[model samples]
Target chain A: MWKKSSDRFEYLQTLVTEFQDTDIEEAKEQVLANLANFAYDPKNMEYLKQLQVTDLFLDMLTEENENFVEFGMGGLCNLSMDPECRDIILQNSGISLVTNCLSSQREETVLSAITTLMSLLTPLSRSEITHPSILHCMLRFSLSESPRLRNLAAVFLQDCCTEEQVAQAEQQMQGQQTAVGIPLPQD
Target chain B: MAAPVGNSSGCWSVPEVYKHHEQRKVCISRPKYREGRKEKAVKVYTINLESRYVMVQGVPAIGVMTELIQLCALYGVVEEYRPLDEYPAEEFTEVYLVKFQKLTSARAAKRHMDEKSFYGGVLHVCYVPEYETVEDTRLKLQDRRRYVIRTAQNRAREKEKQERSNEDPTTSDTTTTTEMTIVEYDKTCDSDNTGEAQQTSYMSHYSSFPPLPLPPQEHNFYGHTNQQGNIQTEDKMGTLHNAIINTKQQLQKSTSFSQNSSDRDRGTEQRVTPNQASAVRFVPRTAHLENRKRKMAKEATEISLTDVSGKNEPLIGPKLPEPPKLDMEDVSLNTTVSLIRNTMKQVESVPDLKPLEKKIKPRRRI
Candidate 1:
């Protein structure tokens, strides 16, 4: 058991290093995606935390490459499922970074962002997560054409916030809406 | 902005095939250390990419829809199914939409049935999130989130328990007290882990205490079926026996296929079992069949004996032995005996005994 754990840790460390050292965009994306997928398994959570892969994922949010942002958000979405990882993300100010991806053109990135936001909820972070602008973003998502996005956003509203908050957000949405989740036109 | 590649529409429209439905090229250039158990495309799966609704294409249009659905039911309860008459299909092949009761069932079906041949055609299965109502999507995400949290919480408690056991040997005597303290600690420190903790401090909030880990054998009960789906070999009583138990489970779901495939499944099991290091003790198929036949014959006699006694018992006294008394040793046999007894009593109690006996006597004679 000890040997296997170490082997897994080492394998993850290799992926992390390859992700950093590789200049090829495709290899980086592949490694990023592999690490994100590994984050899905609970057994790897401890090793990922130890390797500071959480910070690695957080850094990708600010990258110019959209794939980096999407995969990074996806990793965070998986990692934040664990309470410890959620705390780590909260400490790192992950909400704003994730919240930034709410407006990403890619639906997958937006979906991951919303889930990550829901997972990042704690007594301290709940207010920030359900802040009116984010709530407004979720309200927009709730009306999305895609059923997956609309359903996920609906869950975020229903489970992570109060009916009063939702009603207030709805009332406010009619007056002045933030483009927090609205797509910006590309050149 | 690129239109997101998955289910980008609602349920009421013509199901447009999405980009995710196409199988991507497998990644082969990975260095030796990173290859998975199966070669896979470099794709990340988030909850958005999965759904309880799956679309299966490339079914041979040979009017074998019943067989196709029977194959699907082996994975889980197929909630609803209909052939997608308007959707595009490969020349001479058809497409069908299947809604599973659970996303996990759909996932299992896709994993097991995709690329498998049925009626001379291979199947290509992919999630059709486009077909989900908003409620379906909500429940799917909620369930996935809850499952992940549950598994995480269980792992956390297990780690804490191990740490406590290792930290002090004296407290081992007061395991219940130690557990209580841990639960107390969880309530105080890990309050955020429970989604409801901030809402209300009800006693039910303490139910998050980890369930006793399932026994190793019972692990198969919780949908670890796929992991153990492959048949194995065990040297019971020093003979190379074919263990086609998992295939038996699949066969039990669709009995029509069981007749021919029982032997074929056994052959597959033996062939798949790697490396017979023991001096190749080849047990003849006929011998195995004979052994099975003898055991079946013994069971048949036991069943017949119970049936005779069940009918001879008068209605007044404890109307058939306590269910335990009718135990046929196997659960399935016991169930069958109870069913027979119940029907027999029903026949006796109703004022229709003569006609019932007339119907039953011909079958008994046969």
Candidate 2:
């Protein structure tokens, strides 16, 4: 097991170095996919942290390249499950970056972003992660036509928000619907 | 007198006659009344000394003509105004030519209005030279219209290009491009796999070559696997182990490539031999593991043992036998009699307390 872990660590370090050395978009994509896969294993968490892979992933969240952002968010979603990695993400202001990804057109990217947010939400970060606009956005997402998006949004609301907060959001949404001249059906 | 020179039907005019000394002599031979007409001609020339036209640009979109006239009214009366109408409605912005009553008034308007902000844009006012005829101004306006139309078309094209790039990932063409690139990349990896397969084939000819590394892993994790692989029950774990080892080797090669590049950048003459590279990589991996193990052990000790023990405790306890019931009727009879006697004694004290309460209420009244 120790030998296997060392091998995995060396492999991930090589991928990061290759990613930095290459200028080709295709090569970068391959490297990022590999990094994201390695990130899923809990044993690689410390190795990745030493390589400053978290910062690299965070940097990709703002990239114009769709693949870069998607793979980056995927890696973050995987790594954020570890408590140490979660703390690192929070300290680096990863919440705002993950929040920005909520509007991504890619379903996989958005899903990963939501999970990353859920993982990073501690008592201290509850207010930042559950901002009013974010709550409203999630409320809208809960009613999405796609069941996947709707289910994820429902989970986010249930896990991240108090019942009173969710009820208040529903009232606000109803008020907006009425102001737009759309009537709601009574139960 | 040069009067006849001015009144001549087909002869030299007064100004023309004045050009030649001999012609002037001939003009002087004419009547004196023509002399008065020459004075009027000279007066007309002085009155037409400078142009009164002013070119005003940067007119606002709303009510441009009216607003321009109102803006110019402050300096002098506008004798006539012509706003260029050659530009198409959508592309047209404002530029006007106004004829003020005097040259001095045109100069004043230019000084007061040039570079001043009007509506949303700046106004540029300048005098139109006398040599610039209406035809020249019209041609200039047509040229401006063409330029504006060309630029508007270019802007629309650029905006469309940007939108296409932004929406590329969702489009089928982008997916095809990415797929094609991945297929090309896989071919290179396949070549490497074929070499490895050839080596492994000698061990067991019946076994098919191991599936390519790149495709199966990505799809498996993404839950998009489309094919199932057959593995012997005995070799299932062995194949999995081989696959892991292969991936790890590939990663080592990639990182070593970067280290080589970094070495080259540092202007070092020495090349990194495989032994040195492996040694350098090995040291960090072991050191990192040791540090992690230490940290985990420390955390384990820091956690209170009571917390772990408490979590293992059960909510319910063992059942015990119930106590036997006792007959209290005989023993309670004397206790009740004593309780009644004690109550009667207390009641006797209540009468004494009543007098104190009455005394206190009367003192309050006082």
TM-score of the A chain in candidate 2: the value is 0.92
Candidate 2 local lDDT, B150-239, one digit each (tens): 232233334345646776544444334334433443343454344544323322311211111111122111111111111111121123
B-chain TM-score of model 1 = 0.46
Give each prediction's DockQ, rounded to 2 decimals. 0.07, 0.03
Q: What is the C-alpha lDDT profile of model 1 across A1-187, one tens digit per residue?
A: 2256777777777787787677898889888888888786666777777666787788788779998998999889878866667766876667767877886777778888988887777656767777766776677666654567777787677667777889987765443323232221111
* Candidate 1: segments with Cα more than 4 A from true spot: A1-3, A176-187, B1-13, B169-366
- Worst ten in a row by lDDT for model 2 chain B: B315-324
Model 2 ranges off by over 4 Å: A1-4, A182-187, B1-366
Which whole-number lDDT from 0 to 100 does residue B210 have in model 2? 17
Q: Model 2: which residue pairs collide?
A: A14-B255, B3-B34
Q: What DockQ would you assign to candidate 1? A: 0.07
